[model samples]
Target: MAKFKIDINANKHFTGELSPVFSVAEARKASQFHKGLQGYEPTPLRDLSSLAEMMGVKGILVKDESYRFGLNAFKMLGGVYAIARLLCEEFGWGIEQFDFDKLKNEVDEKMTFATTTDGNHGRGVAWAAEQLGQNAIVYMPKGAAEQRVKNIRSHGAECIVTDMNYDDTVRMVAEKAQQNDWKIVQDTAWEGYTDIPTWIMQGYSTMAVEAIEQIAEQGLPKPTHVVLQAGVGAMAAGVLGYLAEELGASDLKAIIVEPDQADCIYRSGSSEKGEMINVGGDMATIAVGLACGEPNPLSWDVLRNCSSHFVSVEDKVPALGMRVLGNPLAGDERIVSGESGAIGTGLLAAVHFSDNKAELMQSLNLNEDSVVLLLSTEGETDPVNYRDVVWQGKYSSI
Candidate 1:
């Protein structure tokens, strides 16, 4: 088994200030726009009380994203919101003037939206393009799950399976988008590509907005800590950025987790907490969505500024987490968390049940008085692999 690893970020840049892109204001703005979308309902925020009890925490809250816009994933929030914002800017239509139907009517010619994804983000881009009466072409990294590709194609978008790894595939799509005059709605930002990705990051903060509101509804205290799973750190930036802005950065602790093979964020933070470092090659892990080798430069800044610690774990760890959520303990709601979605939970479970619980607990500042929030970002995006892990016991903890 690959050993679990942790990195504490030195020289954090959080000074109770919010970046313009992933700020709380942007999240609320995105949330308002999202509310105007058809079939928009906030996904359930489930309290894993039994699991919290088992782990000796005061409260454990999980935002279940499987039901998001009926997409079985939360990525569409970023994808759709970014598209809407892009269109609004392109046509001088205000956000209030940018409802789906109204925007579809305003489109004179079909714009092609293009992006690369391991799975969820591509589907989101494709779905948004389809909804806007435009065209979409999604590119996937080598050996991406067929199910994820199929999901994107179902949105009437062209799906391209590349022979390259994720980061390289991203470059491929960038070239393709430029060649075809397509709008690249990539969630990760590189140089000269900050605005759209920034909007996408803001879109993700909708979950954080709802989670905080839901916590208040339940009369639970604000989350003392947040456990975020990173893939290019887009989702991590969105959620953490908003949280740090809402709750004082110094008040909330952030933990970032990733598959050991693709833990670019972890590696970047660990190396004297310097410039963003990247891992390359096929990150052959079951958590395919989290198999991104490059840290998004936009989110890398947010993560380095806000995150307290980074943890990297083996594939078996999230498989263990899938089992834990799949098989509910007592009255806790069974959340069919996919490999990428459940890694945070898996890491928690591994630490709680391990011989190093004391050390791990202290390192994470996880204690009986702490209220923790975890994001189950996607459901079974690839049902076959999910069944293999949860049913066939592939990558079992034993």
Candidate 2:
């Protein structure tokens, strides 16, 4: 039998009916309302000319989100924006009154926020709550990393470990919020609670908006292929919305990558419906951000229309990504990365392999003239994985 886990699959799944709900102009307006958000930061898009040349591309760039609000991950953008929007929408205040820094400094400590996470999103929600001088309760699965649990606790949030996985944790958190009237802010969407998650997705549009501006300034052509790793599709929705509004569907070919174990989008494309799968075991890839099942319905709608393709990357790709990018940058230059944050570049490598290059390139249909963009959504948050991938160079060893 073919090594199913090692084999790469080329699957093109698209839904012809879904339409864009938010435009770039609308996203821009939301971004303006978030002008002084505490965790907002201008992430850098660094040129990888040398790496691009090595991969036979004209240009390759990495949108480094390592320094986003000093949180070391892009999850904060969505979480913070979602929470801020929820607060504003709930309180009927203008953006000026919801100014995060000002509100954070003055808000009563009696307030509370709640969210469910595999790790990063909960940490982000907890961090945002702490910064805003509010109480936070973070729910996680039973097997969540000690580091993430500790990180949430460090931010003064109560970390409740449930006897379930990430998806179950989400349900538990929702139930708790319903019973207790806690402010539940999640980046993923469900029925009746799409607004906050949509706002969170809108917050992620800042990355795409920034990418377009940075490409213009760097003298690089527009990206021909933009690959993103997704869990619930919030991040991908943000980028797709930007591309649909600014570049149009024909200008940019987009792909959503996920681990073979948690390929909800891949399966959704194949089946033409949203499906939920149980998540458990051996999710050792550092790119843990995308390890989610049960696609976000709104995001699923957008990705179905806007994204051109979906690919399932192996767990090993993340290890390789960390080894490749983390070695020279982290070991020699002191650059650090979290496992879940580095998978964008890993997707880039998987899509550019020599054996599959012919079909992959044909699917994407680009030559040396093509420009590519990858989002590095976080720096190393787990010190142990950081040291192993960066200093030890243990990607293949895994």
Candidate 3:
């Protein structure tokens, strides 16, 4: 197994300051927008008490995004909501006044939505475009699985496999969108491109809102710690923003997990404020969805303050988590988590099982009384890889 690395944020402080950009109220509004869409239902928040016991934690709650909008991933929430907001703005109609059917009928065929992704996010963009009756152009990074490219195309969007890494592909698409006048509905934000990505982050708050309500309905105490996996940190920011609102920042421990090879967030957290660091190279990780080389600028603000700890694990870590979730200890419900989805749980397992367990556990304040929450962000986005890892016990050679 590959060794894990942890970085305690130097500037980590729980200010209890509500984020103006992403708040519980904003998330609630985003959730309302999602409710108007077809196939809108809250995904399950599973109680993995047995797994908690195994890890010696008080409780372990997992919000499974496998069932989200039939896409087997959570990106649809962001993609669709951003598309809606973009349409509303373009048509000069308020969200409440905008009609989907009317927009679909009148939407200009020349208007196209475009984005870049490793897999799930591209499919989400394509799905959103199909729903809105708009054309979509999706670009995927080199070495992206064929199944993922096909999934994007299945949504009636034009899918292109590019000979570039994730970040480069994103830049390429952005430039092309600007040149061709296609609307860019990306989830990651840069300078002067914050508005739509902010909307995307707000949309992701729906998952957090649903999880909090589900926990309350089940009479479970609010999670003492939340472990979120990051690509560009959009989902992490949204979850942290909502949780910081509900459970004060000081009361909750927020951990950001990423692939060691693609540890941009970890590097960013360790750097000086406003300093951008790139975790360069191919970012070859089994968890393709979290293989981002850079942190989203907008998300960095929330993550830098709200996140207490950052952990970067090797590909073996999430592979182990996929196996553990797929074939849980007796009495534990099975969770079909894809490579990206299982990293949070994998990080927890690594800490508990490592030789430096005592020190690492103490650093994160993980104890028997700790209530941990995790978001399983995708489910078998690449089935061939999933089967090899889960059934054959093969570690990704990538």
Candidate 4:
């Protein structure tokens, strides 16, 4: 079991901001990368009018990622892209050279790739490893739910359970990287090793770009507000980066949400520095993804400066949002979202903190027309917990 320590001093070194929004050239590159990715498609951007009415909102849009690459989550784009990019860089091989069959044939079962994840990210890395025929060693915090762990191992990755929380598992992976000749491809960046993580963030831009096109095709209002739930903030950073670059002066506000107990981004924004807060105990929910003690070193600066607001929501919000999306009112959509995945919709309901309800209705202008966008970033990564909360009304208390 790995021990997680709050490194007050280490957090200080992460005080720099994100790179500017993608340049036209960079945007084009990201788009091309998105296009090159195999079996990748934009998840639907659907309106959940019934839920919106229940929340006293004019309109609610859900960017459902449950269908992303048949992986049931958005993490696959980042982790798999990072691995593909790293492999290409090391071998001087074009990414196009990586046919699934060829990559699968190359594995000798001797080399291992290491990453630390709470849930979706690990499943993503494991899925990538299985596709590429590489062995993967995943380090996860001890309290990770069985369903999430099973998902990772089911992808043929070896899972290591640690005694600490998500932050410590990161350190555990770092140590493993040093002791073993394993390639470390992680979504969150640390000092000096920021490139691959940055690539992972860039890969996430594909989703945002897809969302823009999808919204346009649907003839809906442009997204006025984007609610992102952060762990280390990489996912939020990725989406925001693309939106800033492609969406063009759309009066978009990026609202960030985190667990009340694990509110590192909120505190970091308030503290005006990259901050670390030790979670009091085991995580209270199996959103399993957003329970982090600190924001990623590379992402905190970007999140603090670029995001419109950082709000902390109770864990129950996600469970409620998940139920709402799956409810009969939502129709046959089958939006199998998990806790963290529902945070965006949770923020939509808790509009006082968001301060966007008026803007949502376009009441300030009396247009009575506006659009709100929420990202359902994962599917039911923890089906047991999902069933317990949504069906049985019995959620595990932390």
Top-lDDT candidate index: 1
Across 1-398, the per-residue lDDT of candidate 2 in tens digits comes to: 01113333333444433244557775776666555664456788877777677667887777887777777777777777777777776668764457666666655545678888877788888887876777899887666778878988988999988887667778888998989988888877877988888878887887878888889997888888787878878888876877776876756777777777777777776653444333455444446677677688878778877777777767766665665566543212323556766666665565555456766667666578878888877777777767776677655533
Against the reference, the lDDT scores of all candidates come to: 0.87, 0.71, 0.86, 0.70
Error of 4 at 160 (Å): 1.6
Cα shift from native, residue 250, model 2 (Å) = 1.7
State the lDDT of candidate 4 residue by residue for 1-398, as single tens digits: 11111111112233223357433344455656656667766788777767656555556788888898788888888887778778777657786555556556664454578998888888888998887778899988988788778889999999988888777778888887989989887877777788888878877777777777887887777776677888878888777766755554235556777777787776776564435444545655556788877677666656654566666767666766677677737443557788889877755544422345454333222122545678899888778788888888653222
Q: Model 4: what TM-score?
A: 0.84
* Model 1 TM-score on a 0 to 1 scale: 0.96
RMSD of 3: 2.1
Candidate 4 has an lDDT of 0.70
Q: Which regions of candidate 1 deviate over 4 angstroms?
A: 1-17
Report the CA-based lDDT of candidate 3 relative to the real structure. Answer: 0.86
Clashing pairs in 2: 286-339, 286-340, 287-339, 287-340, 288-340, 337-380, 338-379, 338-380
Enumerate residue pairs that collide in model 3.
Answer: none
The best-first sequence of candidates by TM-score reads: 1, 3, 2, 4
* Residue 279 accuracy (lDDT) in model 3: 83
For candidate 2, give the lDDT of residue 232.
79
Error of 4 at 372 (Å): 1.3
Worst 10 residues of 4 by lDDT: 1-10
| Residue 397's lDDT in candidate 4 | 23
The sequence of per-residue lDDT tens digits that candidate 3 reaches over residues 207-293 is 999999999999997899999999899999987998888888878889888888898988887765636578878999999999899
